[model samples]
Target: MPKKRRRISAFFKILTVLTVACGVLVAGGYYVIRSVQRVELTPPPPPSGCTLTAAGDTDELEVEQAANAATISGVAFGRDLPPHAVVVAFATVWQESKFRNIEFGDRDSVGLFQQRPSQEWGDPEQLMDPVYSSGEFYDGLVEIAGYEEMPVYEAAQAVQRSADGFAYDQHERRSRTMAAAFTGAEGPAVTCWYDTDEAGEADVEAAQAEMDRVFGTDGALPAAESRTGDPGWAMAAWAVANAERYGLTSVEYGGQRWSAAEGIDGWTEAPGEGGGAAAEDQVVLR
Candidate 1:
């Protein structure tokens, strides 16, 4: 009887050990799963404005001003002006409106270039329109003799006649960087990120309409239905420049992608359907 009791006690001890071990394993597994869930549920970083650092690399902002600057340069490109012309246009606006479509400035100035209605730049309403203002800037720009050979600031001042002629030079380096990026001279160099939750969803129709308003009538843009291929890259760059204003979360071209959630990290190899060289002939904006 004593031996039998000892055997029974040993069995209970083994059972207890097994039960404790199993509970510990179950608890550990639960902790691991919960940890993974917590990580997965964490939200992406919020969106901010576009960026183009002074060093000509890495940058963030609302993309509206950026888009406007791009459009100004785009108009120059459409007119067959060299890249330097675009640089001059961008630098001019960087000094004038900081690329914004403002209604007021020093004196009676208005718009991105701050063209004064009194000075014959245009009516306030016309100057306020980016396309018209950009056209006006370019129109004045082309009239200067050998403006392309002159320094970017000098070229800008020749047209602007600002009180301070040297001011435009201060933005030359940065403007060149932006012009290169937006003009697609530097392949997917311009990248931006935004907070989708705050901005809501993107509107493709609005994007198409806006494109038509700016570059369409001049035959400078691809078909409104197309967003891929070489022409697609141009449209993609424009869309990226306008990302903040349009609630665009992502833009992909040439096997890379930029996400508003990615902030100033800039472009990266696209992931899955979102990144990588676009297999389709259309640019994807979401």
Candidate 2:
């Protein structure tokens, strides 16, 4: 009995030593690989609202900025759509208009989706509205194959018919990153905010009512945002900086062209989000 016990103890000691050695090798290898990789920390060029300041596209930046709440609702709650649907929608907008809906473009472009007036979409004034624009974009996208359920960029290109169709394919990882930054949902969902610029000073009655009709409850947005905004150019700049998220392009928003001028190392303070305390003032379109 003593000899048997001794043999078992010796075997156990050998196993422990091997396990420790293997663990060290794994840890060492992981550290070496990570140290050698020169990874890009950012999401690449057009560093969102922050980078737009460098391009003197402040007006455009505000247009692209997205509201966290509204975007979340759009992705998580919309019917016949899944959370990943939200990611795709987010990626599309992130790549398109950066979530900004506008009434002007380079030539004949207008609105958030940048549907060309008198060509691909409709008249100028109507196309300028975000809800109308997004709804239309959504309407067309649902028509694509597996779109309502497919990944975002794939569905987007099916609708956009863009030459750079693969572009949407690459935005998924980043889109999920942006969505996770706000509301953390399971795969296929994301969180977002509303565009204040497109409907600036415009009554949010319809939008709020739509929220109630669809969501069964308001998503608890700030009321002051719905009121007439006093924040100078921030409204405009927010739109431009975040345009790509929505899929805005030179030809999409009315042939509106984007160029790099110069950037202010520090952004001149513009009226930021949430200054009002009213309960009935905040709303998000689309």
Candidate 3:
């Protein structure tokens, strides 16, 4: 072949090879992109439990149990009782029913503390109501002389007069941790998460009514700014504890926000002017 012809043939040969290689590369890249797209990119679901941490120790409770624990603590707060009262209540309830408000127990012993109607604690319906039962527990607790200074189990036994008073002792540490969290002794110590899809319809009026019933206040819901200090945090904790039941999407207080969407991450710095400085004192609920 002529030298020019041979050079043109060589050029075509190289061009053909390059074109085939480019097609292969493009196909491989397209497949790689499609494969990545086919893989699920959704985030892992959040854990379905609640945790209360205090003094570097942590304890876990199911969502309902946490709510009941919060109610027990909130009642004491409303009564202006000391955190010790909450500790005693927690220990007693932990021994009695693991924080579950059930209908059956040892011969009509019902509710969180297992108060028996036959023993004149209250009618079964009233005893089954967490707020009433918690109040009754505190009522009995306060009647005892020097309950604040007593061992948790002894104090609980003073009110409950249970078959195994010593059982309360085993739960004292856990009770203390939970009490601290629920009482707001440790700031924002209670963290809870749930499936947002499964959350019930939130009723603000009902929540307010229940809050009033437990706290013994007929007043309106206090603004977060007005309720600064441990009391505010306690209220915030109560809201978090009851978030699932009330369908609370987010709770903002002390410039931090706990969002149901990102609940597993717990509280994060609120977004706004000064990183939620305006919300520092305000507990905005949504």
Candidate topping TM-score? 3
| Order of quality (TM-score) | 3, 1, 2
lDDT string for model 2 (108-209, tens) is 877555577666676777676554555566667667767756666678787766668778777676565544332222211211123323323433354345
lDDT of 2: 0.44
In model 3, where do residues sit more than 4 Å from their true spots? 1-44, 218-229, 273-278
What clash count does candidate 3 reach? Answer: 0
**TM-score of candidate 3 against the unseen true structure:** 0.80
The local distance difference test score of model 1 is 0.73
Model 1, span 1-286: residue lDDT tens: 6999999999999999999999999999999998988785657575466765433565444667778866775565445567788888888888888877899988899999999999998899999998898888888988999998999999999999989999999998777777767666656666666666677577866776676565543324454342112344556677778877777777766667778777477777777553354524556666
Give the lowest summed-lDDT range of ten residues in model 3: 220-229
Ranking by lDDT: 3, 1, 2
- Global Cα RMSD, each model: 9.0, 19.4, 7.1
Model 2: what TM-score?
A: 0.42
Error of 1 at 56 (Å): 5.5
